[model samples]
Target: MAVAQLVAGQNITIPGDRAYCFSVQIADWQWGVIVSRQNGSLSLLDAIEGASISDDRLLLNLSDIPEDIEKLTVYIAAGVNNTGNRTANSSIAPTAGMSARLSDLVDAKEYASIDISQQLTGQLAVSLIEVYRRNGAWKIRCILQGYREGLSKLLESFGFTRDSYAAAVASISTSASTIATASAVNREQTDTQAPVNQEAGDASITLVWKSGQGSLRSAARYFMGKNFKPVSDLRIGCFYELENGQRGMVYSFDASLEGSFDGVPYIKASRAQNQHFEQLLINARFRHKLNRFLIFASMMDAHDSWGGLNVDVEFQLPGVAAQTLSPTTLMVKPIYAVAMINFNDEQTKMTPLDEYFQDLAEMDRAFAWGLPWQCENNSDNEDQT
Candidate 1:
């Protein structure tokens, strides 16, 4: 059968019963191909560096895809190599002379082809095509949309939060010469570092902090006053900003939104139980996309005070000694901005804020976060005089 040539926005129906192959051929070794599920739970299906292409082409079997995956997207980005170097400038686009084709795996007969060479520009990434299931039939559509901001922007547009984007980039960067399959990428993303175990003896043990591995936990411990009544309103939160200006706040009331990225809670919050301590955790990998992190404490009820709440916050990183911070005594304030962590290409620095605020608006203004505050009344404080 004669191959059908398709243009941008055009589509062709595909057979679902027989196995088919989708292949991408590019001229430059700096470009790489990435396949992801487009319909449900956007995820990376495979990533292959151009330099590692077997026959100057990256191929995918459409038949082996999962049943739940109704749609698949094919994307190309720059600097996908085995060296783990993702240093390509966002303004630099992949070289021209790239084409994609779909063919039957058994007969090796081409069904459809599209040349994307003429659409090249100053984009760091581009969406080439999509294979989707509709009415029990598979179809191919030419996308050819380019992202000038590169892979991160493309990923963000596909529902990737700051944490998930960072994790995906890490996976793409560390991809081996062969294609990194979907299962492998998922496994790497879900793998968590084993917690360190301590023995009862005073044995001298050396702690090793593996670079780019593990999580950072921020915890607050406190005690009740002479009356032995717990500070029920005492809570801890974290406000974070990404390099792309995306921002969010995670606290006791909003803990469910903490792990909105790929179902992995990058920042988690736990309320004080039995008048013990409140805690928050930050996945270290998320630091890759985070510009700043602000850790704060607040009392939901405006009438509540920190007078008898001797609270202390601790910052812990794997293999490193934990650092604790005790804020100045505040008897009337309901909110306190405790610390700020700044991330950059060189290093990360955590600075103590230790400033009391009358409300979250004041804290937002202090940091120029520009967040729209939504204050709610505490029902339990209705009987307060």
Candidate 2:
């Protein structure tokens, strides 16, 4: 039979009588394959060090698989510096000319092949395909969903706890050796380039809000009558935790947290007021020492709610498109947890919460921030931005 060329979201049935092998071939050493079972079991197959093609393969025999095992998922994860670290940032991309194939062992013929070089962007991980038992027959589906949050988040989706994920990564790192040649060449090119004003290591967060108009005109009018200043007096705050477990917050009243980790400012909130927006510039180079960075928006007036404004938060990182969260419809409460940026030694991930809260204390408890909420006070003297 002619080999079927599969596209994203395509699927094919596998003959249960014959044994097959799933193989992944890449042009460089930056990518690896992961096989996950339905029972929360995971197996990592790292690509050969400094090799353009992977020697690892997963043999599939439907008859040998237990009846209780309903499904198996294969994932392609981007590696960092060939360190067995599956954490990837937006700067990471697939090496050119990568492909995966399923072949029949009996005739040495390919049953299905997928050219994986297309439809991939800055994602760190991609679910390449899935093998599952459907109607008592083995079937495979091409699922090219990208995980921008990287391998850690993908592992979390497979029911990996923080400690277990750390252990898994540690095991993977034991065999990691030299960096891929492509990554090395890219790094050299980056190093030789002239420095720009906005370094690739820096990131920024911006918050913008406007009074809802059109159908919300009556609601805006009611808010104005109730003295709810959503745009003018809106405040954006960040709760952060350092590597040493020390926690701090930066907001309108606090304005900034400078020299917290080193001499560099970790996060600084701009006091400069704009009619429509507030900005917070973050020094991402210090991310190595940062553990948690949570952002939230709150109303200074306890009586005021966020019902009449359209709130938007944008997170900007270098070399990637800006990720924006518009939670205007979800902002019915006085406090809304906007997002949280998780930074570890491997990668950085941003998760949007968009959850409403009654107060800062409630938000803190929900995230288990353990921040000292006693210092939080509603101050009218603070400048709005």
Candidate 3:
């Protein structure tokens, strides 16, 4: 066995079957050992575990690597905080040293050892060394390189370009953003459509529908409140009929058109295109101030499927009359609903859409309309209102 202290761009050799080990003291920082092919693309040693951090040291078993691989790189990086911030150990004194120990594991003998130190502040990461086989000899080289910007720049020097890294990071960010956006939209909708007090002189009335046991089309005549949130690629609409036999819908997809009932001007819906659920406002009040209006809500779930859904309608007289109608529970389906009258504050009771429709039909109170059905291409009706 031979011992040598080498710096950047040096070389060494080992028998192809000889087991070799590289150990480095990285102190409190995080380090990783990566395998690289001759073409510069990296391999994570998936076939055999080639690297790990043990007792604050990065250990790599070069003997386990496939013969096709030509190079191995070692690096030190910033640690993460509880908040997931990757700024820990981002700064070090000018004298901070990174040292490595190489050994012939099969012979139990030392081969080479080297220490490369740096002098810098606000430095986030560094690539420490590269070991490669040349002409049947294993050669180890010290990088002693530092990056003020962090691991990203250091990785780039190993052939992982910024654009490629950015693309991977963007993909992960988009997935996370989708989940977070849905949760945020749901919370905002719930807060905005909190149940109002009908007993209060200024209280408003509300009605709710839950798409119970059926498809989306059966719930088409119904609509979701503007306050409801959509996860992604969805549209919500409300259907209404007045005493004067006028019928129209207020929908998120269209601007309130110029239309009226009983010549009193009715059905004003905001016109919008590809709306963000957090910003829409659903209004149900008839312009004519009709004594009674029959209405329901529906959703179009486009791009994705959802499980929990319900709708609410708030009603109030032109002056002081106020009341609420809602279901006790939500529905698994995205369309076709069971309507219920909720008279109590903090109401939690839910009725199935099928049962509600059955009771209304038996009592001759159910209006005649096609059952709302589900459509995979248009499943955005959310009625948490």
State TM-scores per candidate: 0.40, 0.40, 0.37
Point out the worst 10-residue segment of candidate 1 by lDDT: 201-210
The candidate scoring highest on lDDT is: 2
> What is candidate 2's lDDT per residue for 336-384, written digit by digit as tens?
7888887765466788887877667777788898765555543332322
Pick by TM-score: 1 or 3, better one = 1
lDDT score for residue 143 of model 3: 71
Question: Comparing 1 and 2 by lDDT, which wins?
Answer: 2
Residue 291, candidate 1: C-alpha displacement in angstroms = 1.1
lDDT, model 2, position 228: 43
Give the per-residue lDDT digits (tens) of candidate 1, residues 1-385: 5688888898888765554546677655234433444344654643321011223333433443556666667777766433323465422655566788887543457999988776667767787888777877778899888877666676667776657655655665566432236323322322332232222111011111111111111122124333333233566777777554656576655533332221122455654334434566554544555577788876544333443445566655433334566656644565778788766673556688888876677778778986656563322223233
Q: lDDT for each of the candidates?
A: 0.54, 0.60, 0.44
Residue 202 of model 3, lDDT score: 21
lDDT score, candidate 2: 0.60
Q: Looking at model 2, how many pairs of residues clash? A: 0
Clashing pairs in 1: none
Candidate 1: C-alpha RMSD after superposition: 20.3
Which candidate would rank higher by TM-score, 2 or 3? Answer: 2
The ten-residue window of minimal lDDT in model 3 covers: 256-265
